[model samples]
Target: MMAGSGRDESGAGGVDDAVRELLLLMPRMVGRVKRIPVPEALQSQSLAPRHLSLLSCLLFDGPMSVNELAARLEVAPTTVSLMVADLSAKGILDRRADPADRRRRIVAIVPERHDAIAAWLAPGAAAWRRVLTPLAPAQRRLFVDTLRAYEAAVAEERREE
Candidate 1:
């Protein structure tokens, strides 16, 4: 049956059409994002894709403690600590004792590395901003929720396999 013809034995083609389009579009989108080159300054950092989320959280929200970051990133505190330690060792991040809470350390991108990290991350952020700009608050929320659901569904499927 034609996917987008809006008619089929299933009563409607909308869902199937959307799925077909996304299945085709996702790989192309991933490939293009992958092609975005790592900036020269960060080339030797050996950063992984997971590092992007950590960096984005810091860049947008300012310095935060490992527990705060772990909460935001939905990862274990130990996981965030390990990443922070690795980045700190690479000179990409700095950790300082919080004045209000000396026992807690705040993690931030090194001042010298901020521009490079921003430059590397700017394109993706800008693209998302542009895409989401026209969406109403509800629509944007729905879009984000949909992506989260898809992620959970994929993880569940993978676990079952």
Candidate 2:
């Protein structure tokens, strides 16, 4: 297996190929994402890239406290708090006292805006789905499983640092 050609089969023969393909493709994908126009609704909101990152974090991880968000983003809690405050002012996010801990506030994306964000992301999702559409059912299952395992490995590498 040629290491650079991405033909290596780490486990499932095509798993390494897929992983390498994705690794190579990631930067271009990110570049495309960075170019996604800020929708009219968000344009007047004074949102920054970091704010979008925060929104993505909340969208995927569910509501979390300021400290948790800070830890996840590797920033200060005060930073997350300020960003949350700004987004809340724009009606893009909601903040409420945590049910389990009144002293803590749980921040979340407004349900109404979730679809807008999803729309912004829809093209990329569609592109991947299109790529996967022709594969056999079992292969699609393997792809998902392989993707999850790859994500875990990457996350573990980050943790070790």
Candidate 3:
């Protein structure tokens, strides 16, 4: 029954609490940082955070329909549709009639703009690296492993649901 009790009690409670607190606060802290005013050059033609998130999803998951994107973003279809339309017009995304279903449109990142998207994401990427850089090699490995385990658990829960 309690197969993990010994391991869980071996100073793991403190580690679990620390991890939980970091998980709870990191998002809020990063969101606050993201909301701070951007430099003039960056602000002149910056994408909103929501748009960045949508782009990131498309970049990672490949092509997706408006409905699928809405589900992934947990937003209204109309909202994703509008965002897709904007990105399409900006040439960052390509929208075409889905081959499997002409009634639906599929959106994907434009190959030509991948570099631009990566450049746009550079600051956030660097910030994340900086945050992890202070950790020792072993701690870094443990942190990454823990995050992967957490992600796997979440995926399994979603599948069961």
Candidate 4:
């Protein structure tokens, strides 16, 4: 496949094309969204992309150990430790000794900051909603289903490796 193109041997070439287009567009789209100037209230404590990604992972997956986080992020353990410490100091993350293993530390999103993070994500969420609004309900459902299938396929491939 080309950098931004997908080849389809089957009859679902249009679906493959749409998926490929979305894959190509999403990174650029998110980069633009990330570059949107932060509001004055949030500017003083703006988050880097990595920080936001870590927070998102914690928010969605709940508490996790440094090693686990490193695996999920595909980063060095020391890198995750640094990030965890930085986020903890910033009050965006909280770290505690794991109950199951006192030797391990668990990091989780700060509950108090959930609203702030959600608010900061509102613009990007709204943009996606608006983009999907043009699609018919059935088409939207199919699109989401297709994406989920694609995600599962990718995960399966990773597991096999």
Candidate 5:
């Protein structure tokens, strides 16, 4: 289902054409946007989006064992272990033996870098704020929900590939 105007037959065709245009332009637009400077603090950190995603997940959800993080990320436990170890070496994350289970390792962000990461993210955050500010509350909710749908669709496509 398309957002904005795909709810009824009268608007379905128009929304379809608009969606086609959007899909055609998105990759080109993203290619340019990807060049935006990483926040200076993150400039040399070499953190990919997925890496930061792991950090964000840890930060927001609190420390978790590697297998749990892998499940949350829909990736292999070994992949999570490697990524966590790398981040730990970089001093941006820490991994400790889970107190309740000696065999489990809990991973968490370093705490100090959260602010720095937020600073680096401010530009994109501000841009999103500016774009959403003019929308009505319900419209903003719809936009967010639609964007999540798109994100899921892209993730599913990647998984298939």
Candidate 6:
């Protein structure tokens, strides 16, 4: 494939074309996501980009202990604990003793705030569903793996510099 032109040996657009398209599309995608305003119920709460994944995990996967959240988030349990504490204090999240294991605390979005949180995050999730729904399972895996590989490569390059 021509590096900049994105044309393959058969003159069919190939890998280069995909890369070029992604490069252009990613920023616009991010901008559109960033412009998804926080719902009125959540506007006064102290939230940030870091909370998105944590909340997304709970929203999509249901409640779990801080350690479970840390593992899913790829962060230290202490970090998740701090975020849980902060969100709980803000009344955006709730912490309750896990029924199955009282020693463990399960973290979740406060029941009353669930709708607002879901409403705030639903658009992006819906957009992803629309794009990925037509793909076969393996194709979806490939797409997700490709993005992860790209992210790893970028991080590796940054670290070397």
Give all TM-scores, in the order shown. 0.92, 0.58, 0.53, 0.57, 0.64, 0.89
Error of 3 at 84 (Å): 1.0
Off by over 4 Å in 4: 1-31, 36-42, 122-161
The lDDT per prediction is: 0.93, 0.82, 0.78, 0.78, 0.80, 0.90
Task: Give the Å shift of residue 154 in candidate 4.
Answer: 18
Model 6 spans with C-alpha error above 4 angstroms = 1-12
The prediction achieving the highest lDDT against the true structure is 1
Give the alpha carbon lDDT tens digit for every residue of 1-161 in model 1.
55455656443456666777799999999998888899999999999999999999999999999999999999999999999999999999999999998998999999999999999999999999999999999999999999999999899989999
Q: Residue 4 in model 1: shift from native, Å?
A: 20
Clashes of each: 0, 0, 0, 0, 0, 0
Descending-TM-score candidate ranking: 1, 6, 5, 2, 4, 3
Stretch of 10 with least lDDT, candidate 1: 3-12
Q: Model 4's lDDT to the true fold?
A: 0.78
Residue 38 displacement in candidate 1 (angstroms) = 0.8
Ranked by TM-score, the better of candidates 3 and 6 is 6
Q: What digit string (tens of lDDT, one per residue) describes model 3 on residues 44-160?
A: 444688888798787767899999999988789999989988878767789999999899889998887776666666677688799899999999999889887887887998999
In candidate 3, position 89 carries an lDDT of 78
Question: What is candidate 1's CA lDDT for residue 18?
Answer: 76
lDDT of 1 at 98: 100
CA deviation > 4 Å runs, candidate 3: 1-44, 122-161
Candidate that beats the other on TM-score, 1 or 4, i.e. the better one:
1
lDDT of 4 by residue, 14-126 (tens): 76666677899989976898786654444666568787667667766789998988898877999999988887887778989899889888998778777767677667768
What TM-score should be assigned to candidate 1?
0.92
Q: Say which prediction, candidate 2 or candidate 3, comes out ahead on TM-score.
A: 2
lDDT of 1: 0.93
